[model samples]
Target: MIAQTLSQLRQLKLTGMASALQTQQEQPGPYEGLSFAERLQLLVDQENQERQQRKQERLIRTAQFKLKAHAQGIDYQHPRGLQQSQMAALLQCDWIRKAQNLLLTGPCGSGKTYLACALGHQACLKEYSVRYVRLSRLILALTQAKADGSYGKLLKNLASFDLLIIDDWGLEPLKAATRNDLMEIMDDRHDQSATAILSQLPTDQWYQSIGDNTLADAILDRLMHNAHRINLKGESMRKKLNSLTQAEHLG
Candidate 1:
């Protein structure tokens, strides 16, 4: 009777531990009654699976990119310091409420892209949608999309993300079409979602770099307003790294 009750409970699956407690729940006759150790092992395996699934879900929620961070020498332990006000503004911006924007300007390797990427990474972890694209690639895609008649669709898709990181601006001057497309993106996301931009050019030169005094000014107007600007002033990281390597070789 005891065995029957246990078997019936296992079959009915009323208890969560049915796999370990009930012999019939596991296998055919002889094998089913075989070993308690086997059942315990299976329970452990199930627990591990659940834990892994949770970890995967957490990663998905964060929407972080291993690539962008890795390339930028971004490590949690070695974050650079901005002023207290700047840090607070970046972390607790009106973007959380109304979805504004962030503009990062500095010489190369002053951590502009690193900070932009970090903010986008933060938004992703908070479960907000995100997209990170290099300015070169973004312009290329926009140009190609226009040629392919997919321009509107692309903008629509971009409009949906909670945050966008446009990295590596000022590497090259923009053409008229590219400038127009950039304005469209700024227009669409303005007051709707946040944008994080990393630019090597200063604000004053943006008009010339963007290739139109009027359009460039318009873009800046939309971007600079209600946005937090972080100006990173430091020596070139590339030159610093090269000097270090050269010194090591000599030693």
Candidate 2:
């Protein structure tokens, strides 16, 4: 019943709004059947809680996709959504289960970040812990920690998320110190925890983009040495959205 209601709500595109509250307000009674007031209280308790959970899920997914959109400079529809088949094997089918990383690369709007976040989401759904952060913000945070004598404190927390995402790699050149911080995280995650990286630059061009040969080499050696690489190929999602809007206008 829960699944059916969720499906119906999603189909009507009302999952993100407050209009569906009424439908969920009076949940079906249990096997023992309750009095009118009990049922009403149950509705208030169950429906409201479920609605909030759905809302939280939407927010989490939106945050994840937004990171991808920013990374690719495109919208969520870019890559036209990750076909379940493309990732079916990685999460469900269980392709090599090691501490290896997953790298997604493609042109702007190709869904690099979306794929990365989706993979992370899948991992969490499968009971693996996850953390999402943009590459630029990560660097900035590391820089601040270094200045305020809290580098270890920050890294200790980072070491915990079962799946860590380093999104939008190569958005800007990495300084020597920032490059080291990136390397440390990659090194620590190597054979220790899972990592997913989303980037516009291809693997071969990463060295040039990172601006540190030795550090880049170390990062790749640890991250790519045992990684699953997914290369997305498609037109820009922004262009596609624009075409759809134009079509609607013309129609």
Candidate 3:
């Protein structure tokens, strides 16, 4: 009977329940006292938990974040102008559901990228699809796609993500073609999907960096109008880590 039950579970693709049943049978002493209803409930719970874990794994795999950052692992001890309360609120991921944008601005090594990745991680935990791409690299890829006549398809793929993280914004000046490409992306995402931009440049300088005043206005109008800005300030985290390493070596 036990073998038949296990075979039925396997045929039904309830591997989690089958595994739990096998464990219960192996350690029968503990489960012997449980009622039949209780045993069935335990199997159901195990199956549901396994399914949720598998979903989270798939979401994380699809995200492709550069940093394996998590909201719980954020360093509140670091004086990087990050507020624990603000981060906690963002962790709920309500902003993403609302299709709002996040703008993270700070100097290099100020943890903008890490924070962005952390938020992306949280989004994945909530089962939201995410994608992280460096702005310069994305622009280059789009340019190449345009040459290959796959630009529209590429944009469509990007638009499908629930949260898009564009890291290293304003690292290079935007050419006319790139600016228009950016505008198109923003247009597609406006009021539809959430976008997070990590940048070393201040918001004021972004207009000039875009090069074309007209296209800049169109792009910024979509991105900045409904965005939450987080301006990080403090010493470089990289320099601090290097100093700590040197101190440890000396000791």
TM per model? 0.67, 0.67, 0.93
Backbone steric clashes in candidate 3, count:
0
Q: Which is the better candidate, 2 or 3, if ranked by TM-score? A: 3
TM-score of 3: 0.93
> Against the unseen true structure, what C-alpha lDDT does each candidate score?
0.70, 0.68, 0.91
lDDT of 1 by residue, 1-251 (tens): 74775677558643434444454454456546658887666655654565555544564454444245422344333233455556545554347457877778888767676666666555554456777888898888888998999989999988888788788887897888888889999999888888877888876777788888899888988888877777767676556556666568899
Give residue 225's lDDT in candidate 1 (0 to 100): 84
Q: What's the lDDT for candidate 3?
A: 0.91
Model 3 poorest ten-residue lDDT run: 240-249
Q: What shift in Å separates residue 14 of candidate 3 from its native position after superposition? A: 2.3
lDDT of 2 by residue, 161-227 (tens): 6678888888888788888888778777778787878898888888799887778788888888878
Looking at model 1, the pairs that clash are 62-124, 62-125
* Candidate 3 ranges with C-alpha deviation above 4 Å: 244-247
